[model samples]
Target: MKKLITIPLLFFIVFPARAQSSSLEKRVSINISNQPLELALKMLEKEAEVHFSYNPRVLELDKNINYKAESRTLDHILNEILGPSISYKVHGTHIILQKAPKRDFYISGYVRDGESGQEIKNVSIYEPQTLASALTNTHGFYKIKLPVQQKDIDLKFSKKDYDLLIQPINNRSDQKLSVELQKTIKPKVLTAEVSAIKTPQVKLDTTPKIEERLSSNSKPQPVPVPEMEVKEKKVNIDLSEELAFIDTTYQKGKDHFLNWLMTTKQNLHFRNIQDSLYKPIQVSFLPFLGTNLRLGPVVTNDISVNIIAGYTGSVRKLEVGGVANFIRKDMTGVQAAGTLNLTGRSFAGVQAAGAANINLGTSSGIMAAGATNISVKDSKGLQAAGSLNVALSEIRGTQIAPFNYATRLNGLQIGVFNIAYDRTRNSLPIGFFSYVHKNGYRRLEFNASELNNTEISFKTGVPKFYNIFNTSFSYGRPNKPLAGVGYGLGTSWKYGERLGSNLDILSSVYFQEGEFSYLDQHYRASLGFEYKVFDRLAVFVAPTLNFYVGYDESLDFSSYKLLLSERTSRWLGENARTYTWLGYKFGLRLCNKS
Candidate 1:
């Protein structure tokens, strides 16, 4: 009985130890066919009953692996799957995979032109396998860090207008290489000659055949040869002569209006019986019945004086007309007309007209018109019109009119309404409504004020200044809602990259329900700070000082009250016509221009 007990105790102790050791040594059967490393590891984890511990970045979990194991030990299977670059460690019940650390070294260099020895900027130096790249700076310096591997690394250098360079680096030691790149050579043009030869003439004789009389060993007489003549000729060509002829024909065909002006001047002068002597001064009674009207189409050096009207092909000095003056070509001197002045082409002198001034081409002098001034192309001087001024192209000087418009404005436009298709740094449109297609600012705002609770506002102008139009409705404590309209001027000052301040002055009129005649007027000045959340969206908060003037004493003032009641009461008398108070406004802005 003692021997039986000893045997059972020995078996019990040995069996438990063997089972505990065999738990970790358990065989796992896993078959993963071309799956991601993460998924394959998960399959192994389920079969082997082991957890994986690793940093995902170091494990390269996205890499694919094809692993198959049948009744194999987990350690053996892991060694078969992971290559030398990766290592694994087995703990109590976990498998840890990690990437082998590598020693890295740097490569720095300069790239220069082989011919001129000048540094080349923006050269790309890259390694294709690693997807590592470095660009040369302005000083043509480049530095790149690479891992120390056993295989050779290929680096490629390339730039525009230069030949490509590929270099091989074999070691991990830091290196400083100066590389010179050759420029690509352009192909040169070569001239070749082609000769033309006329075919030789062959004559066939059909006369009676004569038998040859010659000895068998003697040579026959040589046939008579025909003389051949060759001739060579050189041709001379002048391109300028052909071009001049074409230009003259084009000019004559294009100047039909000029021809008419010349014909009219000659015919009118002949009818007036003017002397053949060249006279610089001539007076005309009417457009075609003038002293200078008989002058040739283009007056070279003549001062035209017209009592009522004048017509000329081209004016050189001065033209004065009582009613109107018309020129077909260009006018170089001062032209003044009682009614209107019109030029078909450019006008280079001062032009003053009582009614209107019209120039089809460019104008360079002061143009004053009682009604309107129109220039089809560019204008370079002061243009003052009573009604409107229109320049189809660029304007270099000031334009003063009730309405001014230009394609490109390089100067100031002072009018009630101004429009510029292109705006420059110096182009300023100071008016009620200034619309610049290029550099103007436009925004839609929703604001709140003491007098106007909810206001919808439209603001437009340049970056420096803008005009505001506001319409608000207050429905707070008043028995009937009050509606108000306001006009204001605002200026902005930028403080930071996304912060700005705005100063505005506004005057508004509020009208009560069923009473259109009686109105309350309020003047307000505000300073606001705007924070731009996006390129097109902004939020603003402002502190305002308001002066309210009540037209009706019985109207309720509760709708136009603010938080600073204690400070406002000190200035408000018992029976005061105007009262001042502090107010606050918060709003959002949607900008159409940057």
Candidate 2:
């Protein structure tokens, strides 16, 4: 990234506009920007069903604010957007989202002969919970994910070649077994001429016991008969063997080659985007990437806003803020913000930010970006500003800078562009801007950013679109006092995949105010990879080969210097990001370029 790294004007914030008075509203516009675009769009459908289920009517408000129409507030918008399909819990402004489906109980096993230990095929297993029934495969194995609770179970198994078998479990823990068949025995009839077959006979006599005879006049006592009990023929069990089966709820994670050394915050800060980006994707006649703070692959897309917001704590006095987006396709995007140390401590100073990006680009596409310093008050305690800039891009296509300056060259744009500056200043101030672009060939751009102080940088390149490599050259102008050119050459390579790689190498020569002066020189090489081995997400990695050379002419000696060039990248992996729903959160921020 050149010195003037901040993007000029961020893609404006667009949202749905509403009229305060209305009854029986079938629909309304939603203005969700700087929030999660992917997730928000999905949440809209669930929220819009106000006619009945989920109570959308309750989410909708019938009131006015500052003489405005009855409309939804940010809080209500969030509430409605969070519908019932997804289980979500909210604390303060942060939301916890979770999805719950009927739990699955998996049953898997093999079948074999009760005595021969031979694998059995076409064996059936059934569970009523899921109406799941399966036959053993060729390997005599069967598996199922169902809902089978603990209870005595009944299952019937029948094979054309074998006899029907009914297995009943008196207890849930009873192990299942197989059936064995034996050959039926045949009996021969006996001959009638068998010798000395004797027939025995028994005679019955009616008599009374000695005690009963004397008491014959009294009532006779009832006789006690033996008890009758019948039992099922129990299935044979090999008690020596221990049957093992365990029900569990563990899913197999997909295979992903992740380089743990690659963390998100550390990688997304790579190659700063120069301030001269153009917008080819837009809604209005104006040249814009998106309407307001919303951006997307097409005119209408969603967005996501996931960040922690807080004012300077009394103890820490920390002012922190960040905005995120799903600019390309999925919600996977980038972010940038600032923090002012308000702790009234030794380290208490306003911290400005210039970041590259925050997204894991696999869901949507590849991206490149940069953020400019927004700190109006510097470490030196200056109030006004040195300069402000912001330059962020998704993939390598159109840039969204409307205020930056550019020269319409064939492929090498030469002129001053824009710098992203922090607008939350101590007092109000005004400035001027310029911009130009042509959508042919490899792109070229230049930018000049700031207030009072100055910074300059330029980029010329063939966007490595459908092909593998992007060829290019870059130069960062010395800030003010040393206003000269610093030059470098490089290219990038990528294989589009969940797991992909990228490499770039470039060397630069810096010049001071004098044309023949050499202030610095260096070489930078980088390696990166992108992988999407998970659901609705992708991971990114960026590491670099860095070396720098510094010289001081005042000493009349040329010295070789070696310093490491820090490289950065991002993994903002979000999908279905809700930048703005067309019928809902879709409006434009009006800016007059004339």
Candidate 3:
């Protein structure tokens, strides 16, 4: 009987380890500043290099719009991508978009002296057609394509150093012309016999004979020619030829470094990491394989494009892989590590770890990990990732979760604040979002969440997916959490991924199907910050002030808004919002590729 019982327990235990474990994730981000509607549209259409449609007129809720662009969206995506690019006026329930200016297919050409055949180098060339333009090359050849509005058009040409040339074109002839550049004879040059006295280069245009002194003392050596130093005015002189600047050396250096990282895919281990934002830390290798392509601008002249691809998996641990810029911070109050952790990786944008770690004060980011850490935490850009921040204190915002932090609860999350009973409210069912950045802690996150009259809060700085919007809405039940009903929603605005503190205005009225006279409505406007406190932790605090306008007669919404925990270690998740008690929350969250 004992042997049979052991076999059954082993079967159930091993099954979960072999079953569903992880989900994959792809990410993209674009940042476009508030340029003019027309210009902004053109930039996105012509510069956003992604597989999406670039229709300024099309509006889809949560769909990928493949488009192509030439310029980089690096900075634009830093602070403004959480909302729509173009704002529209709402007509009742409908939204009316602003109309954009019309453009033309421009036509442009050059003007050279028909006789001397001398092409103007600094020539002004314009097309009445789309206003597109180009100057003539040294060979006098120019190329241009215009968005012309009308068939009959006019092309204008004028240069500060050259005469103005205007030509009219009709259906009569193929558009082309050549005008002579009459020599620009200047007034100064025409007047010859330039006396050295006025040249200014002559500090003392001295000719004792040229001046007849009336002074009695002729021997007094005429007022010592005050050696006037006419500080030479650096008149910017435009060189006659365009300079062919060479950057071959720098390019070669950058290429060599990147090539080494790509080609030399040997297992590498790094120890003793001291970064600006976080404390000291270490990372190992989890041998695996995958691929990654980071098509963002190399603001750091280090490299332009980053491509990391490989696979990683520990002998008795999870597999890890992914490509990204590795940024770390120094650890404070160091604690010695217990045993060796597998960090060997072989993929792009991914990582995995499994082992007991002892971190006294450390900051790090890991993915696909099953770590039993005594005090190890996951913070990106200085902010935590969940509503019930496990150990650390101080957090803000709503609806954020670190994919599997609540994995111990399966699909259900059950955790709370500090184990000690402080005036600060402890366990409440709140969710959080921590920000992940390019190099590491360049930015942080803010999030908020409440459900089934349980604890729910938000913080800035978190992660999202490839060109996807983000949003989450949940229902609250005060008394019974397990039996209570719940609903949640997540979405993205505009193109998503741009995260900075911008006033977010969201309105939703849902009469959730079922009993309980459910009409939930809220108006919350909070300032958010994506901060990088240290290498290991980035915290974002937005003291929010919101108003609950809509009515739910069957429920006292305010009570749930300020949920308090009876036991300092845990409480109902829905009470995160309706109940009021100075609560101290800390988050320890994790995210993998997904």
lDDT by residue (1-594, candidate 3, tens digit) is 999999999998876544322100112233445444344433443433322223455433243333332333322331132134433333222223443343434344556764577775645455433333456666666654544445765655555544455666554333455556555456675556655565445476665553365444557555665678889789997753432232345445533443344312121111100111111111223212211111001101111111232211111122212332321112121112222122211111222223322222233332222333222222222222332222221121111224313211101212221121111122122233222222111111224344222222332222211111123333433422222221221222222332323333333333443644444544344443433334344444444434343233344444444443222111232221332222222222222221
Which ranges of candidate 3 are over 4 A from the true structure?
A: 1-470, 473-519, 527-537, 558-594
- Per-residue alpha-carbon lDDT of candidate 1 for residues 1-594, written as tens digits (9 for 90 to 100): 999999999998887666545544779898889899899889888887878888887776887898777898776777677666777665556667888666677899999999999998877666644535567788989997777873678877777667778899987889997899999787887677667887999989875444533324566679999997877777878799888997677556545543454444243332322222234665777655654434433343358777887666577789898998877668888999999898877999899999999987789999999999999778999999999999988999999999999999998899988888887775777888877777776778998765567889887777676788888897744532388888988877778868888888988887777778656777889999999899889999999987776655555455555623322222233433556678888999997655
lDDT of 1 at 188: 82
- Candidate 2 has its poorest 10 consecutive residues by lDDT at 577-586
Return the lDDT, model 3, position 562: 48
TM-score of each: 0.50, 0.18, 0.17
After superposing candidate 1 on the true structure, give the runs of residues whose Cα lies further than 4 Å from its correct spot.
1-279, 291-296, 476-481, 495-497, 554-576
What does each candidate score in C-alpha RMSD?
Answer: 38.7, 39.6, 36.2
Please count the clashing residue pairs in each candidate, in the order shown.
3, 72, 143
Better lDDT candidate (2, 3): 3
The positional error of residue 44 in candidate 1, measured at the CA in angstroms, is: 99
lDDT of 2 by residue, 1-594 (tens): 543443322212111112111112324455444445344434444444321123333332222212111355433453355445444443322334455333444545676665577777655554322224456677777664444363545444434445445455343332434444222234678867778868888878777679978867767689999998988889998744342221111111100111122222111211111111222222211112212111111122122221432111011122223432222212212222332111111222233333432221111222222332221111211111122222221111122322221122111111133322221111111112222223211212222212002222222332221111222222332321233233443333435533444343545444444555434543445454445444223344445444434442321111212222222222133211111111101111111111
Q: Candidate 3: give its CA RMSD in angstroms.
A: 36.2
Task: Arrange candidates, best TM-score first.
Answer: 1, 2, 3
